[model samples]
Target: MTKTQARKLPGYIFLSLTALASVFPLYFMVVSATNTSRDVLNSRLLPGTALFENFSKLVAQQDVASAMWYSSLNAVGTTVLALIVCSIAGYGFEVFHSRGKDRLMAFLLLAMMIPFAATMIPLFQMFADFGLVNSSVAVILPAVATPFLVLLFRQSARSFPHEIVEAARLDGLGELSIFFRIFLPTMRSTLAAAAVITFMTAWNNFLWPKVILVNNSYQTMPMLISNLRAGYVTDYGVLMLAVLLASLPTMVLFLVLQRAFAEGITGAIK
Candidate 1:
């Protein structure tokens, strides 16, 4: 090998090992899903022949389809709403300048410091009072105004060229139109990254969904898989199947938006 190739060999080897390590758990889960409970419990290394049977059992015991649908719907809804709200709020905060606005922005950012658990009880009470409990509204409402997303957008918006805003203003474009026409298209990658993040959070959210969705009819994937545990003997094969199925949306989302996700992170860091 050439000298340069020899020098980079260790780095490549290390990266290959890291990539394999990262993928191993997912590989293991897929393998386990195909196995019976006994085989999975024994940590079988190869794919088994029980894939369809396990999936069938999973469907029989729980509303896997409904859970998938609810989870995907709620996640998508939450993402779209959050992006709209966050982008608007971020653009407004970045563009508008006043002492009062600065104070409000500070307060908005400070609100992010408080853990969600701290506010959960009050939020639950408020939502329950509004008759939104056991509904998608309950989940999406609290998540709609994510301060982190707002802050992320605001920071990213700082990099937006004021020249475009000025030109748009000269052409008599309204604020909303400028944002929709100019800012949205310019920040497509950032928006995609944010959507993926929001979707992942909403999809994988266990505690909030669990607390709100006590009724099996309203439960999502996390709750459904959790519910697999009845009094005493739980179905391992079925649980693995459900888990594999539950993971599909998030995995697909990440795969599709991974480039944007990387760009967004680098842009934010820059």
Candidate 2:
């Protein structure tokens, strides 16, 4: 092989190994979901006929469906609100360009560095005061304007063409119209990536939901999964099934939108 081709071969092998490493756990989870608890304890890697039994156990659990629904609602709600707010904030921060806004952005970055544990009590108290505790809104409100998403949007907005904005302004398009009709469509990929990240974070969130949601009826999938594992005789097969079901939406979303998500990120960085 040519020297360049030889150099690329190692990178390709490394990538393949990394991909396998990532997929291995998911494969194991799928296999375990199809096995009995005994089979899971024995680390069985092959699919078995116990899938229906495990699924039946999962469905028979009173809160499983409700928890899944609540989790889905929280994930979808948080993603939509976060994308709208953060994207707008990001676009404004980059395009408006004021010293005060720059300082605000720096403060936001500092806020991001603060551990969530530090603010957990205060956040919970605020939600309690607003009578939002035990609601999906409680899980979503604190995440709607995430600093990380704001930063992502700001970076993506850097690639937004200034000439287009100027032309839109000259054509008498209002600021909101320009943003929605012009900028949004152009930055679809970046938004898709942000949406995926936000949805995953919301779906997998445990600590905040566990703390805020006092009612078992309103618990999320992660919280339910935790409760399941903590039971006296934990059923590994059932737990695996719960995990597989919990993971389905994000997996499907990534499969459907991954191309746009990847391109958006690449474009933003470029």
Candidate 3:
């Protein structure tokens, strides 16, 4: 090989090894899902013939369908609400040019530093008082107005063309009309990124849902996976199968929107 090529070969080799190491756990999990419990405990690295048996056991023991439904509902609901609310807040922060708005945004950003554990108790008490405990609304409401999403949209909105807003206003379009018709459509990439984030967060959320959703009927996929290991005799094969099922939606979503997500995070206008 040439000298330059030889020099770069070590870097390429290191990256390739890192990539393989990152993927190994996922490969192991998928293979374990097809093995028996004993095989999984023994750290079998190859696929086995018990895939159907593990799936059957998982289905028989858990309400997989109901968990999927509730998780989907919560995720979709949270994504839609967060997009609408945070997008509006972001648009206003960037375009309206009002005094103290920056300060307010900073305050909101600061709120992110406060861990969720600190507010969990008060949030629960408030929801319980409103008779919303064990409800999907309780699970979704607290996540809809997150600061990170608002900040993400605000940063994306910074690149939005103000000339379009002024032109639309001169043509007698209302502020709301200008936003929904012009701004929303223009920020599609950021919105897609935000939607993926919100959906995944809502779908995989464990601690908050576990605390608020007291009813077993309203369990989400993460909760279902948790329950699989709650018993005395843990079925590692079935547990891996449940984890695989829980991971599929987010994995598929990321694969589909990955391009948009990247563009959005980097503040691409298109």
Instruction: Report the number of the highest-TM-score candidate.
Output: 3
**Candidate 2 lDDT tens digits, 1-270:** 999999899999999999999999999999999999999999999999999999898888747878888999999999999999999999999889789998999999999889999999999999889999888888999999998889888988888888898999999999899899998998889999999899999999999999999988898999888988886899999999999988998899999999998997787677
Give me the runs in candidate 1 sitting further than 4 Å from their true place: 98-103
Clashing pairs in 2: none
TM-score, every prediction: 0.94, 0.93, 0.97
* lDDT (Cα, tens digit) per residue for candidate 1, span 142-168: 898888888778778889998889999
* Whole-model lDDT values for every prediction: 0.88, 0.91, 0.93
Candidate 2 wrong stretches, greater than 4 Å: 1-14
Kindly list the per-residue Cα lDDT of model 3 for residues 1-270, writing each as its tens digit. Answer: 999999999999999999999999999999999999999999999999999999999999999999999999999999999999999999998898676999999899999999999999999999999999999999999999988988888888888888989999999999999999999998899998999999999999999999999988899999999999899999999999999999999999999999999889877433
Per-residue lDDT value at 136 in model 1:
94
Q: Which stretches in model 3 have alpha-carbon errors above 4 Å?
A: 268-270
- In angstroms, the error of model 3 at 133 is 0.8
Best by lDDT: 3
Clash-forming residue pairs, model 1: none
The local lDDT score (0 to 100) that residue 86 gets in candidate 2 is 94
Tally clashes: model 2. 0
Model 1, position 216: C-alpha lDDT score: 83
Q: For candidate 1, give the lDDT of residue 22.
A: 99
